[model samples]
Target: MVDLDPEYVAARGVLLDALEALADHREAIVLVGAQAVYLQTVPLPGYQPYTTDADLAINPSLLGPRPGLEEAMRRAGFRLKDEDTGHPEPGIWEARIRVAQRRDDLVVPVDLIVPEAVAPPGGRRGARLAGEHGRRAARRATGLEGALVDHSLIEVGALDEGDSRRTTVNVAGLAALLVAKLHKIGDRADRPDRLTDKDAGDVLRLFMSATSQDMTQRLIDLLEDARSAGATRAAIDRLDPLFGTPRSLGTQMAVRALAGVLDPATVQATCRTFAAQVLAALGGAG
Candidate 1:
């Protein structure tokens, strides 16, 4: 595993705690967000800038009608974050845990999201969960429709040196991850200031996952079997204008994000080249 900061290690510890808390519903859980990408990228988690939150996309359909995810989480000491802080984000929940090397209980947030398909239509923008107790356990997330099917089961271990917790979880694969990242990126592309260097850097790290050639070939196979090809196709459509050249805004943002650990020019050149191979594997459709 990549060495993580003590804070991130605590985040992982909390994540493991949450996952284990929902152990009965593990198969129904699809790990998304940076942690999902981190799981697939393994030995190289990110562009040397580790992500902080653990995001999970749960399939309510697979979870039985009885006890729901919210109930399980609450049973494990998780509470609605907004309720505690008087904020309005109902989908966010947190738990306090005492870990070694930390003087106090760390409050780590676990973001619960679900495929938009499962969310009730007309969109108040939350999951169709009664939580078996009528609670807004998760929020509706776009581009996660394919994730319930486009993922791989992996054994995940805590990054904390003091935490020995481990469990098997389904993590979103490369194409699904790219699609999710692009979904978030595409939203902010028009407003470059809103585009986070973190998201751009994530795209580059994915491109940096395996050899460009190998990653492209694997991506092709993934797209072929993907449930919602449109999502990945839309992701591909965003790439050329975004990372088709070394100077593209997306590539530049990635360079900026990784500037802390890598040479800027090299990262820019590499992203452009990898972006080309990826697009080519899609028959240069965009």
Candidate 2:
């Protein structure tokens, strides 16, 4: 595995501290988004610095109202921010806490998302384009509240740091994470501004970390299951263009951010391999 940057370590420490504060809701929350990607990729080679936001998904059915959640986060040093403003908007609630004693005014964002049973279309065009089968698959993949309920708890941080604070939190399984990425990428057609290259990069990193055979089998299983659930071949076909399309502005920014740390060639190769696997898994339907 590649050595982790000190900044990444400190960022993770902040995230863990936040998670520790919400220990009462630990079981009800599953880590998703970029921070979750960081955790999943830590054991693998290559380094991708995490964004400021730490995303957590909750099952509203199990957790009930989120008013208490906001209060709990406020007590933990996070102040809620309005999503209409330029901030990290993961779902319904967005919050951030400035790191104490940091000269840069560096802040860590926390996004509390309630995975909806049915995800709204990316846009009017996306709604018309996706049709019923595509919408259902997107909903099934992104509605991870139930799918990720039984996530694994992993210890983060180490005993050597001065803080030596190692905290464990529930993380969505790789399969679920992959599905979520796919759903996000597919929805980009409607919300081009919101979709970033980091989504594509995360997918590449996840694919590279998984052994080819394992990824192939896992994706095949996932696709087969979705196919059985009335996800038509057309629904599967919609994802094809996302893989081959030009990089979005967000992706370009992400690449520039990691320019020195990650090899460009490796990133490209992993994307190509993943695209091939995706096509195969869908039986070359596209």
Candidate 3:
């Protein structure tokens, strides 16, 4: 078993605390982004360990009152961030919460991202959830129902093996995490400045860590499941171009973004192999 690093352990603790605080709204939330990646891959080899934030995709309809959510976070030791001046703003639907940990000076950020309006066809912009309509769109495209089945229940902050009070959080399924990562990387061509090296590196690590065979099977399974669950054909089609032969500009950007993560030769080989697997899976789906 892979050992959980101190940073991930602390982050998981914070995430668990947040989940416990929001237990009343658990059904409406789906953990996503880097934190979800960490949770799903923690037991696997080559799991990258650099994120200090937890991101959750929340249904706007269930978010209820902002004040109540804020109060819950505050009670769990998180302070709401009033402003974010960072480039490519987080948008209006996203909220950041910070907590001071006793072990270090680093403040952990937990981001709650409500799905905004769906982007136009072939748009490569960020996933910003606008209002209730956007939330519905997100649920449809992401096959939210499938996520509920593929999730793993993790017990956090347990004092002992039998600790009954240990908090449990439902992590996003691996397939959901994979789709989200691919979407982010696929959108890199449209927002190169905002899509940083970390994003590319994460995608690379995700592909490299899982064998092409395993990934191919997983994608096929996810696609089949999504289709059966009434996910839009458009949503499934969007993923095809990303796996196109010769690779798209976004794929190149992802490769270029991995300069220091791995040797150039290895990165190229891994990308090629992974892309081939994806294309094959797409063909099989067809």
What 10-residue stretch in candidate 2 is worst by lDDT? Answer: 131-140
List the global CA lDDT of all models.
0.74, 0.54, 0.53
lDDT of 2 by residue, 1-286 (tens): 4455555555666677667766776776788877777677643334445476666765433453333565566566665454347542233333343454556655555556545433343632111112222211111134343234325887767422567777787887665566666666666657768767667667666766776556545545544553212222333354445543335332343354346666665555555556566667556432
Query: Candidate 1 on 4-109: residue-level lDDT in tens?
Result: 5767777787788788877887777888888877677634324454665688887876776656777878888888777856664656778776666879877788
lDDT of 1: 0.74
Which lDDT value does model 3 have at 254? 52
lDDT, candidate 2, at 197: 67
Per-candidate Cα RMSD to the true structure, in Å, reads 3.2, 7.7, 6.8
lDDT score for residue 44 of model 3: 26
Sort all candidates by TM-score, best to worst: 1, 2, 3
- Work out the TM-score per prediction: 0.85, 0.66, 0.62
Give the clash count for each candidate: 1, 2, 4
Best by TM-score: 1
Cα RMSD of predicted structure 3: 6.8
Across 1-286, the per-residue lDDT of candidate 3 in tens digits comes to 4454555555666666777877877765777667666544533234345566677666554554433555566577665443334433232222233333444355566766543332223323333334322211122233333344355666545322233456666676655566666655554547757766566556665675576667656556655653223432333354445533336553554566655555656666666667667666667767
